[model samples]
Target chain A: MDIVVKKIVREVKRGNQDAFAELVDLYKDKVFHIAYRMLGNAHEAQDVSQEAFLRAYTNIESYDENRKFSTWIFRIATNLSIDRIRRKKPDFHLEDQVSGTDNLDYHSQFAADIDLPEDQVVKLEMQQWIQDEIMALPPKYRSAIILKYLEDLSLKEISEVMNLPVATVKTRIHRGREALRKRLGQA
Target chain B: MACTRDKQQVINQYLDEEMTLLESKQFEEHLHSCPDCEKHVRELKKTTAIIQSASHFEAPKDFTAGVMDRLPKQSKTKRWQQWIRRHPIVLTAAVFFLVFVTSLSAGFGAEEEIVVRGDGHFIINESERTVVIPEGSAIQGDLFIRNGDVEVNGEVAGDITVVNGRHLQASSAQISGDIEEINQTFEWLWFEMKTLWNDAVPFLTPASEEE
Candidate 1:
């Protein structure tokens, strides 16, 4: 898959429009998911995801193939989501989980691997509840927590995406986790 | 036992596995004695687990196509036309200012003439291309200057018109009638619009750049 992606990236660098389209198709879900989790709104997530692809297309010459393409695209999506959230200043309430309903029924392979049906349901509900708590967090803390968990990025990788020091990323994650503990524990 | 703030920070670091071996051992011993810190660590671990289990969202089926459609096309002429269409006010102001400045500069090198009418005592300095109306001099009829400049140092009871010429008014020069330059209606309108635009340019520029 890496080899195929690398080949497509090379073709894209050579100005093949179809290759770039293929690249967008490959990362669109990941980008959209990151944006959705960051923004807590599906429409805004879709907009940010589309914009991230457009930005990647325009700035393709600046992409360094030595690094993973996913990380680069994720970084662009992260920046756009952060900027959008900051600019709009949306009032996030814990009760408003409209975006949470979009994918609650769609479980991952890991969730399916669970032996018991009732346990899977509980796990899914817990996941949904955690997502609501994450949405209620401040943008910076929300970004750090989402990237650390959803993307499963290392602190160093998150630092690069956020353009912050690893120490700062760790601090954000710690604070974000503490906030979630307080909020979710109450519920 | 209750946990100190610094110890609580160490507990968080330990939970994240960021502590060194020695630090971890010390923090473990402290946590063993402090039930509050132990409970906090357990809750943090659960929080981390729940966050990691959060679901991924799927993009709409047409997302890629939509983005491709919105991408900047390679045609320069289309982009230029789009830009011109978007900023109608800016384009109009630019054209008006250009024409205004061009007309003013075109009239610069023309021959000088001064027409002083009845009871209008004036001094003509042909070398300077200037006609000075004296302090006490008051003109009854119209004073028309063509291809020259007028320095109104005294009162004019009648209309003063300058054609392809510049007008300078002093403190004593009060014209009872209208003073007209760039005589056509559209030309006056364009000139006024250009002046208004020039005054407004500084305020308009930063706002446009921000967008």
Candidate 2:
């Protein structure tokens, strides 16, 4: 996967616009999801995701291909999204506005093979509940937790993306887990 | 082995899979004996699993195309803007240094007063810390004297303006221009604006480029 990404990156560095477009295609959903989850605004998520890809392309020459391209792009996306959120809402507390819907149509296959529609509904609600808890976390801790669990990145990867120490990333994930556990009580 | 430290720490490390083999064994043993700790670990695991299982939304159609369209064209101005964004602190310091140096140059001059002497030209002489237009010679253009006193002793062809000092014009000094001592508040404001504008030109270029 890294080799394929690197090959595309090389093509991009050689001024292949198509290759850059392909790279954006590969990471767009991941970037959008991260931005959407963080900002809770689909429009802002789109803007941030677009801006992230633009920035990545603009700085492609500076990118070190030795590292995971996903890490670098995710770092850009998260930073742009977080910065946008911070700028628009400086006093970002736990917004009670869980405006996202359960659009798991694409991912429903990953859920348990339950025949009951009510079971699926309960699962989606539970997933939404978890998402609200995740969003309630401070952006720093939220990013760490999302990258660690959702994106399935290692502590080292999260640290690299966040430009934080590995220890700090671990601490944030732990604190985020603790916060979620408190909210998700005895479930 | 006995568990002595914070149980929460052990649970967190266990969930993260960071515990050593020995530590894991001890933590599992402690968890079996401690129902509360076990529940805490279970809830944490559930929380993590739910987050991991959260549905991911696909990017909207034409999202990559939008990004491609919005990507900055490979232009010199774009590259320059990128450079400025990357080194903002350095750019700020450079602007500060330039403003400092320019203001210093405008504000601080040599203690020796400037002497301009030419036939049929401005013969403003600042000997003994004064601008004295010596007799018979004419200042051809505008004369601006700052600091010290201005003593006009000869002919002048243009405006003679003195600031922050007394203007002493000899009766025998021929004057074909206005002898104005500009000491108004607005004049000072205008002078300050001119100085700032001159010093700020380089710093304003990037902003214009961005636009």
Best TM-score among the predictions, by candidate number: 2
Model 1 residue B160 CA deviation in Å: 99
Candidate 1 clash pair list: none
Residue range A1-187, candidate 1, lDDT tens digits: 8889889888767655556889998989989999999887889999999999999988988998888888899899999998998899557443444454753332331244546699788877776667678878998999898888888888888888888999999899888888888876445
Docking class of 2: acceptable
DockQ, per-model, please?
0.36, 0.39
TM-scores, all candidates, are: 0.56, 0.57
lDDT of every predicted structure (CA atoms): 0.79, 0.76
True contacts kept of each: 0.84, 0.91
lDDT string for model 2 (A87-162, tens) is 8845433433334545333343356755769978897777677667777898888888888887888889999999
For candidate 2, what is the TM-score? Answer: 0.57
Q: Candidate 1, TM-score vs. the true structure?
A: 0.56
Q: In model 1, what is the error at residue A94, expressed in angstroms?
A: 9.5
Among these predictions, the greatest lDDT belongs to: 1
